[model samples]
Target: MNIQQILKISADKLRQKNIPSTALDAEVLLLEALSKCADEIPPAPFLKGGVLANDAPRNDNKRLDKNWLYINNNYELNKKEEELFNNFINQRLKHKPVAYILNRKEFYGYDFYVDENVLIPRPETELIVEEVLKILNNDRREQACLFPTIIDIGTGSGCIIISILNELAKNKKDKIIHNAYANDISSEAISTAKINAKKYNLNKKIKFIRNDFEKFLNKKSIYNSNEIIITANLPYVKNDAYKTLSEDIRKYEPKIALTAGRDGLVCIESLVKSVLKIKKKYKQKIYIFIEADPDQMSRIMAISREKLANVNLEIIKDLSGKKRIIKLLYCHPELVEGWKAR
Candidate 1:
């Protein structure tokens, strides 16, 4: 059968089986099948097929012409094709995410290894990195000539924090993070983050700390508060939300990484209190940005303003205009007083 025929057959099968990305899924599966089998696919006229007549409508048939797909001597299915197709179907049937199946997730123009141990890096989280880099790059912070010291709280898989370091490395500016740090409550997560760091040669620039970030902050050693940028991608999915997750997600993914308690404010609340206490003792205002569930924006903002009364806080929206991030400046009470007195 030709490319168009296979796509129609596969997409219909996927739709019948309730796959979400039916068309896209079909394309991926078929393209991989062709590549694995060394099938010869030519840029011939849209090969007419039984699917084109009735079962598949002609008009919106995706217009997938010869130019769209690549087929060569590899077009014919082989033993490898069967294995690849079986693996993809089995994983998808289990609702495992594509990134996990591929063992890589793209973020900030780089790919990081991700598995069930850590939360999958989301495209939305890149906004936090973008904002952090912007603040560190062109602001007064840029004048110090010191490499930007960034600490990522709950740095699962080290994606967001490492991406910033990687981007800066290209400019010979990564030396600033000579003091960079990343902490996560899970040892597995810390290990995974370290792997990514080592793979990118960012091991020297990033310090992986396997500890509860909240507890670390509550410690007596508050000198670390001197970091200019503190970013976190904390667990914010609510307990009720957990009930709504697919069976595969609930059964296979890490529970600790997904659930954040009843109101989904456990880690966030602890973080707020710790940062507040640190700001009071250190008296140094530091910039902080964190990613959270859009639904939790009100709760997050309330915690921010209440705990950090002296600071200015704003909710950052994602590309879709949802409240996807929280940005805060942890200012000392005196800073607020000075501003008000002015």
Candidate 2:
């Protein structure tokens, strides 16, 4: 059958199975399957329409561009292409995420490898990276410090920390003498993050630690007046709420990275408590950015009010206009007067 016919059949099958975004998922999976087959069979028939397996094209420019797969969807699929496409369709019927089937996901203009071990990077997470850039740029203009430290808590897939490093390296105004840390309790998550760091040639720039928040804080590290930024996208989905999530998420994605406690705020609360201890011991102000469920904002703030005595808190809304991120400026109580919550 032709390419268009195959896509239609696969999409219909997915729709019958109640898969969300069936059309888009069908297209992505088809392209991925075609790309994978192109490697084993050189100058493959389906590849003539410009779908090379490798990331970059050959130096001689003989290899067809990868984008051709999406551009020329009307091209015919050979017998081998039909076999591979069917297998992918079967996987999707089982509620597997397309990113996992493809082993790749794009975030903040950078692509990273993903699997069942880590949570697939979402678009909303980009906001955390954007806010970090704005804060760092502002600090460069106002402060005389030459080095800044970045710590990413529960850094699954290492998307947040690595994206930040790539952006910071581009700024010519500032010398990039930054110490970055990414810590995760799951060793599988840490391993996946290390793979992504190596993919971007950022292995040395980031220190990937396989430990939780409390353990990381217990280490013998100095926290002086130099700028420190903490970014956490820890688990915030409640246990009961996790059960209500779609099969595509609950079945395929790691549960350790999704559900918190009964209230969905246990991991976040623990991280905040650790930050309070760090602040008291070091006596240096630190800026924190976190991603949480929009509905949990009031309870999170209440936790901060009781545990974090001196903090300036602001809640940021996601693109959907829902409360998504919590920005906290942890410093002395007296300094809180000058800054207004945004």
Candidate 3:
């Protein structure tokens, strides 16, 4: 069958199975299949005047853009492409996520390798990267010569830390010295994160630690910088809420990366406590950006207030206007008043 016909059939099958984003899933899977068949078939012809047929820019050289399918609606898929597309559709029908099937997810405009071992990077999580960049930029403006240490707690796919480093590397004027570390408890998750880090040529830029966050934080020797920035997208889904999540998420994504505990704040709470200890131990300027469910923002603020004195907290809303990131600024008591005014 041709591209158009096969896409319709696959989308219909997914729709029948009550899958969300049926059409998108179908197109993405077909594009991936087409990529695998690239060795057999030559690249699709460009449209008139050197413009892309679908008008969408190609991000991956290995994968064809979805618009290519529209441009080549009548193009016939060979046996290998047809077989691969069908296999992917079957996985989708079983409630698997498209990211898991593709083994890749895009975060902060960079694609990272992913799998069942790691949580698929979410769009909202990009807010953490944005916040971190803002902090780094602020340091540059103030001419803070001190090197900052960035720690990404529970770095499932190392998306947060890697993206931050990639952005920093892009700005030639960025003179801030910094260190980056990705810490996760799961060895498999660390392995997946390493693959992505190496993909972006960031293997040496980030240190991957397969250890619990609390334990890693206790090792004072690792944190040698006075300006420390922490970014975490830890599991904040309550146990009960986890059960109600869509089959695509619950069945395919790693559960340990999703659900926290009864209150959904187990991981965040522990992180806060550890930060307080670090704060007490070092008279340093610390900034933390944490992504959590909107409903849990107030509780997180309250926890921060109770544990750390003179810490300033801010809530950053996502595109949907949901409180998605909690920014915590804690520093030496003498500097609190000055930082709070900003």
Q: All candidates' TM-scores?
A: 0.81, 0.87, 0.91
Q: lDDT scores for all predictions?
A: 0.72, 0.81, 0.87
Task: Show pairs that collide, candidate 3.
Answer: none
Candidate 1 C-alpha error for residue 300, in Å: 1.9
Q: At residue 36, what lDDT does model 1 achieve? A: 45
| lDDT tens readout by residue for model 3, 1-342 | 988899899999999999999999999999998887766764455654576544443334557776667767877788998999999999999999999998888899999899999999999999999888876766454454667888899999999988888898897433464678899999999999999989988898788889999999998876787688889999999999999999999888899899999999999999999998998888778889999999999999999999988899999999999999999998787566766786
Residues 86-128, candidate 2, lDDT per residue (tens digit)?
9889998999998898788999999999999999999999999
The candidate maximizing lDDT is 3
What TM-score should be assigned to candidate 1? 0.81
Worst 10 residues of 2 by lDDT: 52-61
Error of 3 at 231 (Å): 0.3
C-alpha RMSD of candidate 3: 3.4
Stretches of candidate 1 off by over 4 Å are: 1-9, 29-74, 145-148, 219-225, 333-342
> lDDT, candidate 1, residue 72?
25
TM-score top scorer: 3
